[model samples]
Target: MNFTVLVPARLASTRLPNKPLADIAGLPMIVRVAQRAAQSAASAVVVAADHADIVAACAAHGVRAVLTRGDHATGSDRLAEACALLGLDGADTVVNVQGDEPLIEPALIDACAALLQARGDCVMSTAAHAIDHPRELDNPNVVKVVLDAAGRALYFSRAPIPWWRDGRIASTAAALPSPAPLRHIGLYGYRAGFLRRFPALEAAPLERIESLEQLRVLWHGERIAVHVAAHAPGPGVDTPEDLERVRAIFAAV
Candidate 1:
């Protein structure tokens, strides 16, 4: 049950500059994320930051952080360095929590880690919830994941999957599938060993086209267990509007 939670944060964000340092109820956004993660069952929660300012912010808030190279191409790359820096063993479990999700559910974090530990056959685990709205299914921003009978991810894409063949018309399908398609949450759990080696895996064509990193794992014949959460997680911060929404929520609390 012992796992580490790694929050990958970068200050250079295109949508919200210095996003990790953005204030939410007087606390830095990354600090809030780390605090929420601390409520999880993880043995430790640390922020893997690209900038010293982010590290200092975390430290100021009594949160642990590791300074990583600023040039990492992806969050996973930053996490890989964090794993090495922390000296996590190959068998250890690590949950990757995004810095922008200030209201992320700690129980969801715990569930993802526990699932990874239980599914020895899988190298990683992630959470997803059924899509209730047709517009969400069509929205490219909402990534969808299809699962096998054993709850292993079959595929993840921006395009609506389990596409309703019978409802297709004019190249615009707006029908909700019978069983409900899943919207993939960005939370992830990993075996520290697999996580360390992930950055070296060959990029899959679908990954590049879909702009999803998890496809590379499938392309390399690695399995990812999917946890079907009861409900969708809280909104994550991605833009000024998202930040404001999260700030309002925190302020009310």
Candidate 2:
């Protein structure tokens, strides 16, 4: 079987409530996200969510959605359950797309899945983009990632990384380095077998300190393939202001 794309949507968010149902271009945000996932080369595109509201929204929009465990700590956990419900085999590749990204490109989805397929040694694959703006460098909300020459992730941190000992790192007040920094994109692709083992792995100190589950995989000595996306990932709708901003952007598309 070919790879499957799972769109993970949650109704609850600390910053903005009922984000999946938020309207963008007259359709629910999750609906628009699903539409984008459908453009992928995936054999199937399904929404994995915990709330009935999200499920109903997908149904109304003629999209496939499945209710998952409400207690899943992470979106990846939700995707695992979605795969189980769909009866995917261990070797099946699963692409996890965040539902808040209504404008996520289908090509990005295909690219991530293709990377995982090409690199059989890695169980997980994700993406990054060169951060050019000065504001994005200091924005703690925009997670940063550094990768090795082989395009494998070295670290994922919310703080500024690769401190320039002579330039930016030399002075506390020095301007942040705007070039070569890669902002981590939230989309992920994982083999079904590895995903089933994810929940059982003990949490690592770095993961707990940073509140990032992906860190646990790195800390456990596993390599995650990183793909450099050609374009910036569309801004995800996390706050009310962001909702308005995304709506305006989608309105023009």
Candidate 3:
């Protein structure tokens, strides 16, 4: 049941510059994310930051953080360095909570960790929810995941997976599949050992093509347990509009 939440933060963002340090209400976005993660069942919550300013911001907000190499290609790579820095045991559970997700539900974080703990056969765990909107099936921005009977992800893609054969006609295209296709959630949980080994795994062709990192795990013949959540998660900060929306939500709270 013991798990650590690692929030990977970096100051360099093309959409919103210095995104991690961006102000949300009175606190930095990274600080807000760490605070939310702290509400989970994690034994500890730490921010793995690429910039000194990000680390300083977390410290100012009383959130533990570690300085990671700024050159890391992905958040997983940054978290791998963080795992070493924290000296996490191989068997320990580490949930990767994105620093931009200040509105992430703590229960979702706990569920991802608990699922990873329960599925010893799987090296990682993530979440998904039934896609209620028909438009989302065609929206590449909303990643989709097809799962096996046991709830292990068979694949993750931007394309409409488990494509409805009978619904191929334009008139029926808007109809959802028999069992709704799941919308992949970004939340993830990893075993410390697999996380450490993650950086060394060769980037999969599917990963590069879809621009999805989780594909590398599947390409390497690793299992990722999928927890189907009842409701969709809150919006994450990505663009200026997303930031403003999140700010409005926080202001209301």
Candidate 4:
């Protein structure tokens, strides 16, 4: 299966201003993300930048970058315009890799694309891993996904899902039950045609309440294939603290 990785980068960030240009090791964060995506099975890797500076940063590192409209409300919307600009066919697969995830694994990108290629009925695919800590299950920042019998996402939310009625909430990770909850990863894969139509889909109430864009697909009666990742995804840069943590990890390496 052929796939392309599109890194959607915006200049304005509420938590960390100009996050895409933030330094990681020596290279910019967006450049690092593109370098990792290039190692995957994807046929091409491109950065769909919201600003000319972001496009220039990617170009400096010899990565393909495209300037997209800055007014896009969501990453999917930005990628939709990118697909049109690239002139990608309807059947082609595209993976949406966030620009802030400098530590993202290339294999995870391939896995997500492969899931979509294998599942003809599903319009999109994403990954998740089993949560090992009780705190993570309760944390609203860590999204959780409940899967159906066929490994399709039943729902994605910030709240604790499949609430363990028999178990009591505890502070320690050891107190969690045998079958732990699954934490949803932020990566996604979609067909180029579906990606174009994504922006046209009406915003769903569940999506607005949960603040998860994927829920819009479920609300509109579309199937999303959920792949259980072999390992947890690396942390993404959302705040100054997150940037420091990632920088420290790179420095240690």
lDDT of each: 0.93, 0.86, 0.93, 0.92
Candidate 2 C-alpha lDDT tens digits along 1-253: 3798898888888898888998888899999998988888888889998999999999999999999989988887787788789987577899989888887888999999999988887889999998766567677777889998889999999877866566643223445564568889998989888887788889999999988889999998988999998779878887999999998987787
Give the per-residue Cα lDDT of candidate 3 at 51. Answer: 89
What does the lDDT read for residue 176 in candidate 3? Answer: 78
> Could you tell me the lDDT of residue 5 within candidate 4?
96
Candidate 2 runs further than 4 Å off:
169-179
Instruction: List where candidate 4 sits over 4 angstroms from the true fold.
Output: 172-174
Report the poorest 10 consecutive residues by lDDT, candidate 1.
168-177
What CA RMSD would candidate 3 show? 1.4
RMSD of each: 1.7, 2.2, 1.4, 1.2
Please provide, for model 3 over 107-161, each residue's C-alpha lDDT reduced to its tens digit, 9 standing for 90 to 100. Answer: 9999999999999899999999998877787789999999998999999999888
Candidate 2 TM-score to native? 0.93
Q: Which has the higher lDDT value, candidate number 2 or candidate number 4?
A: 4
Candidate 3 Cα errors over 4 Å, as ranges: 169-174
Q: Count the backbone clashes (under 3 Å) in each candidate.
A: 0, 0, 0, 0
lDDT of 4 by residue, 93-161 (tens): 999999999999999999999999999989999999998888988899889999999999999999888
Candidate 3 TM-score versus the reference: 0.97
Deviation in Å, model 3, residue 234 alpha carbon: 0.5
